[model samples]
Target: NREPQLELLKNFQKELTNYKENLEKVEDVDSYKKDVSFPKICKTNDDKRKHLAELFEKELRDKFREHSPTKTIYTRTNQI
Candidate 1:
C-alpha cells in the first residue's frame, strides 16, 4: 500500500539528513584541493583556459601513469 512507500520515503529523508549533518561536521581542510601548481600570470581568459587545460592534461597523464607504469605517454606541446 501507499503507507509502506511513505514510510520508506521518511526513512530515506532521515538518512539523507544524517548524511548531510555528518558531512557538515567534517573539518573544512584543503585536502580536497589538487596538488597541481598553477601559473601566476593567468590575467586573461585565454591564459586561464590554457592553465585549466594544462591541469586537466596533467591529471590525465598522472592517472594513465598510475594505471600503466610501463606505457609511454606522448604529450603535444601547444604553441601558446
Candidate 2:
C-alpha cells in the first residue's frame, strides 16, 4: 500500500521536476512556434501540457494498466 504510493510520489516529483526544467528551456517564448508565433504563449503552454501528458502516460498510466481491475490489492491485506 504505502510502497506503491510512495513510489508513485517519487516518480511524480521526479517527472514534475523534469517537466519544470523542460519548461525553463522553452521560456524564451519566441521559439515554440514559427508561423504560429503570434500564439507564442499559448503554444508554449500547449507544448508543456502535451509533454506532461506524455509523462503521465509513461510514469503513471502505464503502471495503472498492469493490474487487473477485478484483482486489485487494497490496503496492506492480500485477501481483499
Candidate 3:
C-alpha cells in the first residue's frame, strides 16, 4: 500500500541523514592523521607498545569507515 511505502521512504531518509552525520564526524580523520606523530623510532618496549596502540587505533578508525553502507549505496546509484 502507499502508506507502507511512504513509511519506508521516511525511514530510508532518516538512515541517510544519520549516515551523513557520521560522514561529517569522520571527514576530519584524514587531516588528524596527517598531524599525528607516529612513534616509529621508539627505543623502549613501553614506547613501542604506545606507538602500536596509536597505529592500531588510527588504522581501525580509517579502515572501519571505508565500509559505510550508505557510501556504497551512494556510489552505486545513478543520478539523473
Candidate 4:
C-alpha cells in the first residue's frame, strides 16, 4: 500500500516537473499580446461590466446581510 502511494507521489512530481518545463518553454509573445489586448477590451466594456458587477455585489451583500446576525459588519468590507 505504501509502495503504491510512493509511486503515485513520484509520478505526480515527474508530471508536475514536465508540465513546468513545458510551461516555461512557452513563448512570451502570446502572453504579451494577451496582456495588451485584454486591458483594451476590458476598457471598452468597462462601463457595462463594472455596472453589472456592482449590481451583483450589492444584491449579494443585501441577501447575506439579511441572513447574518451582524448588519454593519459586511457593509464596511471592501468588495471587488
Top candidate when judged by TM-score against the true structure: 1
- Runs off by more than 4 Å, candidate 3: 28-80
lDDT of 2 by residue, 1-80 (tens): 46775676577667767766665667553455343324234455656556544544565544643543422453224444
Reference-based TM-score of each model: 0.39, 0.37, 0.34, 0.35
Cα RMSD of all models vs. native, in order, equals 15.3, 8.4, 13.4, 15.0
lDDT of each: 0.49, 0.53, 0.50, 0.48
Ten-residue region with minimum lDDT total, candidate 1: 71-80
Q: In candidate 4, where is summed lDDT lowest over 10 consecutive residues?
A: 32-41
lDDT for 46 in candidate 3 is: 47
- Estimate the lDDT of model 2: 0.53
Candidate 2 vs candidate 4: the lDDT winner is: 2
Clashing pairs in 4: none
What tens-digit string does per-residue lDDT give for candidate 4 at 13-64?
A: 5655564455444554235234233333344343334433444455554655
- Kindly report which residue stretches of model 2 are placed more than 4 angstroms away from their true locations once superposed: 28-80
TM-score of 4: 0.35
> How would you encode candidate 1's per-residue C-alpha lDDT over 2-63 as one tens digit per residue?
56545655655565556444444445312322564447786654554455555545655555
Best by lDDT: 2
The deviation in Å at residue 68 for candidate 1 is: 0.8
* Position 38, candidate 3: lDDT: 50
